[model samples]
Target: MNPASPIRIQGIHYTLPEKQVGLEQLSAEGRLLSTPETMRDFGFGDCRVSSVPATVLASATVKALLERHGVEPGEVGLLINASVLPTSSLVPRGEALAEFPSGESAHLGLFRFSSTRIQDELGLINARTVGLSELGCVSLSHAVWLAHAVMLMEDLKYAVCVNADVFPDGIKREVVYNVCSDSACAVLLSRNPEGMHLKRYHTLTRGYYWDPDGHQNELLAAYFPTGKRVLEKTFKESGLAREDIKLLVPHNVSLRSWEILSRFTGIPLEKIYTENIRPKGHSVAADNWINLKDVIDRGLVSKGDHVMMFSFGLGAHWGCSIVQV
Candidate 1:
């Protein structure tokens, strides 16, 4: 897994549904808290959605990837869904745990409603579903890492990684509104290099030190460190550093989170490629893939550009990948 090895990204597609939810509108719905103080603190403007169910975004994204790549759906060996909104209540405890700083009382109803819609619309079959719900902004990147791993182990010819979310309506809590948006992105992955090759990956996570008095450290411990550790190990195994990376894509949850991660990684803030947060706000799990597609579409990463991706969610789950153009 040499970082220098080239991985080609053949096709990337994303969907931003027509429906848009502004901060002002959410404020009216009592779902988004829009006090001046809160707005200044969180740096949230608005979010997006589709009139259709969240799962439709997933299906649409998958279809878009297939159409763009001119590949058939049956050719896909796996379908990995990285979403913040689950359509099914069957298994909500694992990755889809509900814990908001604003508490769950005000938001649970909306959550259940959207989750039901997601379950109803995404009657996806054939491909195994790797459900990642609560991972929030980092879900898509984690899916990408999983896609790469699957390519390494299985006889899979192609993998479809889909990320979609619809910021729940009737969310009366502003704290929950600003950073959440509705969007979907689909990426087609293959072992063959007729497209992009996945050269290497690095992930690192460290939490919960042995200390009796510092209970506050447990807060940071909420994030899963195993995936993060694997990312770092992969980087070391590949023998490369940030300097060799031409572009960096991170899960941009907020302005502050982006700044903190930039400081922690020592990657210049300017080198990071962020989505149109001011325009589209945060698209939850779809952020990473959408940003990757933006990079590809804007011609920001030319062929042979060394792109690095880092993503993590509340569980402190972190994943990183290095792909060569």
Candidate 2:
């Protein structure tokens, strides 16, 4: 039997506009979410939009992914946009070949690529969309798993996984105050060896609730675990113990969840990078790529290191994938 095609993360890039963060970057502007005055004072307006559109983010990330590995967009067999926000026409946008096209009005919609319409417009034959409403935080790794499955079961060569999510406007500061932030992440996944290859994939979900009366409760119930039993079941199912993971990127719901996971996994506090305290904040679905991007860009890992990822969404869903760098 032929072996599975090795899945590698070729290149990773992200854009966080400087002008985007108004008061959030200021020291004096800091305040707790419980205060309505602070919420009003801060410009946590409707979700943030990139200086570029959703497709721009996808295109830029794809371009970087290709250029870094000396590959071309045309060479990519599949393009998957797990982005919560897709272009208006829902068409493939990479065909434009330019980041910002000024005089291209009529062909604007043609270049946009929407994963939802991949199988219909193109003879993708097996293309499918994983909507953010259904995917939540686990979308990127889920796409990786699907692409791996396709490569193993089919004869596909390459797949591009793009994740772009913008926090919508009018979100109560108190709502996602601790754990949510705005950001975009894109990754090109393929069977190439220059990039880190996937060795195994594991997923676990444990039910968690914010109960004040239970003596271990605080914060609002922003999200719930998909299934109670599934959360603690990953350690044994993944075929490796928690100590085997050199790095872990989980959904950074809040400080409380971090503490809960640290206790549950028995991993060190320093190994977790999702507890972000900065202008970037906690990016939802983009957490995995963003964290991995930092690791790759900073030259933090060796060739044989293993990176474990955990993603949980609002649907009470959780996903985990182990990559060997």
TM-score of 2: 0.70
Estimate, for each residue in 174-206, the C-alpha lDDT of model 2 and write its tens digit: 334442455556676776777777766665433
Clashes of each: 24, 16
Alpha-carbon lDDT, every model: 0.60, 0.54
Query: Using lDDT as the measure, which candidate wins?
Result: 1
| Per-model TM against the reference | 0.74, 0.70
Model 1 over residues 106-190: C-alpha lDDT tens digits?
Answer: 4553344322343334433345556656554567766777776776567567777777765444543333324566677877777
lDDT of 1: 0.60
Top of the candidates by TM-score: 1
What is residue 34's positional error in candidate 2, in angstroms?
A: 3.6
Query: How many clashing pairs does model 1 include?
Result: 24
Q: 307 in model 1: Cα distance from truth in Å?
A: 1.8
Model 1's TM-score against the true structure = 0.74
